[model samples]
Target: MKTNQFLFGLKNLDRGQTMKVAIFANDDMTSNIIFAQLFNMSDIQITGLYIAASPRKGTSSIIGGAISLLRRMAFGYWLFLVFTNGAFKVYEFLTLVFRCSPQTGTFYSLRRAAQLRGVRYRKVADFSSPEIAAELQNSNVDLLIIRVGDILQPKILDIPHYGTWCVHSSLLPSFKGIAGEFHALRTKRAPIGSTVFEVTPSLDEGTPLGQVAIQRDETGSVFQHMVNNNIAAGKLLASMVLQAFQCSAPSFELYTPQSQLKSSYHSWPKPDELKVLHRQRKALITPGEAMRLMLAAFRWG
Candidate 1:
């Protein structure tokens, strides 16, 4: 949708209607950026947070999560993930020990971000727990914003009066599942995009509350593009939440259900797909970019 169309439906909130919001997310660099945007909001109260240990279900422990990954993909790719995650975890540890603020565009864990915001958070194995549902009800949560891999159960979904919404990294009715941005990159989608949608039982097939797309940078690496896309998604989510809180609904003009469109759902990128990216001369992550990111995550002081 165009920028004007997105803004056309926004209405200012009355003084007494502050939304009590909760967040469900994975504790990663991208989530940290997203959480920062929410924490900065002055109007709504963030009632609670659920930071999943892993995006996957049934395997929240280090050992169980690793085993789950191996079951889904090749061992080689799992090793690649281990190394990549290890590096980020080390940076998170450093930030904690040193007590430093993350530099702009740098990585930080969601836990650190929560601490900085002074918001209490809970680490959960998955989102299906009755206990979590009870907590949301007890907190009088008005809305639930989710950016996790676990599919929520109806009990959890029913806790929030306004229902759960998700921040997705691709234009809905196009790339609808995991790594949508990656799929867009490999498929050469001209302008990559992000969507904020109402989460239903169907994966990514909810009503799109807001969306924005950008022209892909031809010169950037795949990792760079993905990171930038996620950052955009984070900002987009914050804006949508504010709009929803103010008006009690996203502008009716913006409500397009995914079922009405030719939406495609994607799973994890296969090994051949990764090879195809390389064949197209696209580097997933340049070593220089990785090193620069690591250095920026640390406090020089």
Candidate 2:
């Protein structure tokens, strides 16, 4: 609890401005990481956090922290929404360990995943509730951001002042839905990273707010690609949110999708296919001192 308090203090101070934010998040590490990083640079006043626990656990949970940051909002309120397929498993027998699978994720999982990366959560609410709409109406959110997860209802999507913005895992008009990075990997091609855009009634069909191309090496796994893309997406979203809070003109220019862009949706790989896919991705790692060095670099304290 003390750690959480300390982290929250740091988040508000980092941004150098205060924003009223509500967070809907689950998981642990990812949320903390990025929110923390953003707070380090700006001042954000987090209003509340609503986290729906992943389906693994069969119940929902909520977590909240204070947000103080770099920019000041004359009347800015923010919400970090989370959806998850609730699931929890014990890694060991008696240590109260838990594991969350992709299938068991809900909206909360999205928020949690981001928070685990060091972002602070302010508020939370489950998606199915009428209260969610009421909150959005009252929260005075200037903008809403959606990442990978359940599609928000029209009420929430349309409530924000500037409308909602979303981050698609795949390049727009290209790969959409699940398995975006996988498709790119299978095709032996590297594309731009994340596509940021304003939300419309249709998923992944929003107008492009911005698109950022990532630098990728010749040999890299779709997993790595996803990590790289997510980091970029997180930063992009943060920057936009910052600008919105300040009433500064949106940094995103109008982007219209172009032709010759192939788009497709992919389902998660099956067991047999997953095995093959894993092996293919691992093939890039190869056996070498470099692999060991990489492993040595990424460890938890």
- Report the number of the highest-TM-score candidate: 1
Candidate lDDT scores, in order, read 0.70, 0.45
Q: After superposition, how far is residue 83 of candidate 2 from its true place, in Å?
A: 20
- In angstroms, give how far residue 97 of model 1 lies from its true place: 3.1
Sequence-dependent TM-score of model 1: 0.85
Best by lDDT: 1
Query: What C-alpha lDDT, on a 0 to 100 scale, does residue 154 get in candidate 1?
Result: 83
Q: What digit string (tens of lDDT, one per residue) describes model 2 on residues 81-165?
A: 1111011111111112233321121111333333443434433344535776677667765445544345567777766554666
At residue 254, give the lDDT of candidate 1: 35
lDDT of candidate 1 over 1-301, digit per residue (tens):
3233333333433558777889998766566766667777888888877888764676667556767777665444455456555656777788777765643455646666667767678988867888888889899887888888777888888888767888888777787777776677777644577877778887777777777665687667766877787777777777777777677444422324445335677777788877777777876677887676656545331
**Model 1: per-residue Cα lDDT at residue 165:** 82
Q: Total backbone clashes of model 1?
A: 0
lDDT of 2: 0.45
RMSD (Å) of each candidate, 1 decimal: 4.1, 13.4
